[model samples]
Target: MLAVAWAASGDSHEVRLCVTDKRLVWLRDDAIADRVRALRLAEVDEVVARTGRVRRQGELRVRARTRRRRLRFGEIAPGPLRELAEALAQVLPAGAVRLPAA
Candidate 1:
């Protein structure tokens, strides 16, 4: 994995957003073990990063051609997510990922 950040989604325990060479993976730690969902960089449609204010951390959303609903994680650290976005942009097609102006 290239980068990883603490992610929050509903009631899932130990949620994480991981950036890899070929894919973006969402890992959920359940009672049994870790469950993973991956989206290939080549198939990604868009990546949206929303910065948080004083009360919130941040949010990261990813959309892929194969998935109907966007994968969203809140309370994400902006630093790691920015790095992940940069890493993803290198592998994903042009215009596939979107990042807020710095």
Candidate 2:
């Protein structure tokens, strides 16, 4: 998912949320030649996906100690959001994920 990483220090950067068996990773991909994974899944302290206004608009946040990555619904649909949430839930610790209601 395409998102922006916001740090507690008031800095933000475009990031790509990538999930792997070992962990969830954040890749920096903003008009660059190559995409580099800047953060790993182990850095995720909490994760949540929220639905707003009829489940059409969704907001996903994967946060670490002092930074957060968010994916909005601008380029995402309901199906993708569901899939992303499910995928994230699988990688995250049990009972740590709260997907939106069906």
Candidate 3:
């Protein structure tokens, strides 16, 4: 499964995406947290898990934005926790992934 998380505050935003086999969670910044919470309450995905809980066969994506910075995480692999960390490192905003110019 593929999941995306995005938050917008003022003029800046943060986004994250996670893909797994069972579940997905997306966390938004304070500015958009209400909307995100509402979506979660509405069960936007086939399955949803509360924040900070890790699932056995699922994925979790979180995004948070404040006033001056944006952060993102994507495609967390499952296996060893370290593997997930490595994957995150490769996909985070400062990582190897590159964005297309607009």
Candidate 4:
């Protein structure tokens, strides 16, 4: 499991990559509550491809400290997002993962 957290422009966001069943599970702050939410790798891929690059994954969970207020999406590098997609690709069943660069 790899956990990465950073505060972009004063707002804090956290991303956790976990290997489950040989698949990568991405969990991030919901921005609505202190709870976390899991993101589907396929959905993320589509968003990246549509935007011509991987933008922020958007709010994953609600913030507990912010009274359930949603956090604004932050910017992420396309390279890192591609890397993450690759990581997810490895875990998905064969032919399920479609990377943006592929």
Best by TM-score: 1
Q: Put down candidate 4 lDDT per residue, 68-101, tens digits, no spaces.
A: 3432333434455455445545654465444454
lDDT by residue for model 3 over 69-88, one digit each (tens)?
A: 33333223333223433343
Q: Give the TM-score of candidate 4.
A: 0.41
lDDT of 2 by residue, 1-102 (tens): 432322111122454555565655555445365555444666667667766685465566666664645533233355655676788777778866778779
- Give the clashing pairs for model 1: none
TM-score of 2: 0.61
Better of 3 and 4 by TM-score: 4
In candidate 2, residue 39 scores what lDDT? Answer: 42
Q: Compare the candidates by lDDT and give the number of the best one.
A: 1
Q: Write the per-residue lDDT of candidate 1 for residues 1-102, one digit (tens) a residue.
A: 787888887657468778888888887876255487777887788988877778456777888788888878787777776887787777778887787456
By TM-score, rank the candidates, best first.
1, 2, 4, 3
lDDT of 4: 0.38
- Each candidate structure's TM-score, on Cα atoms with residue i matched to residue i, is 0.82, 0.61, 0.21, 0.41
Better of 2 and 3 by TM-score: 2
Q: Which regions of candidate 4 deviate over 4 angstroms?
A: 2-34, 39-74
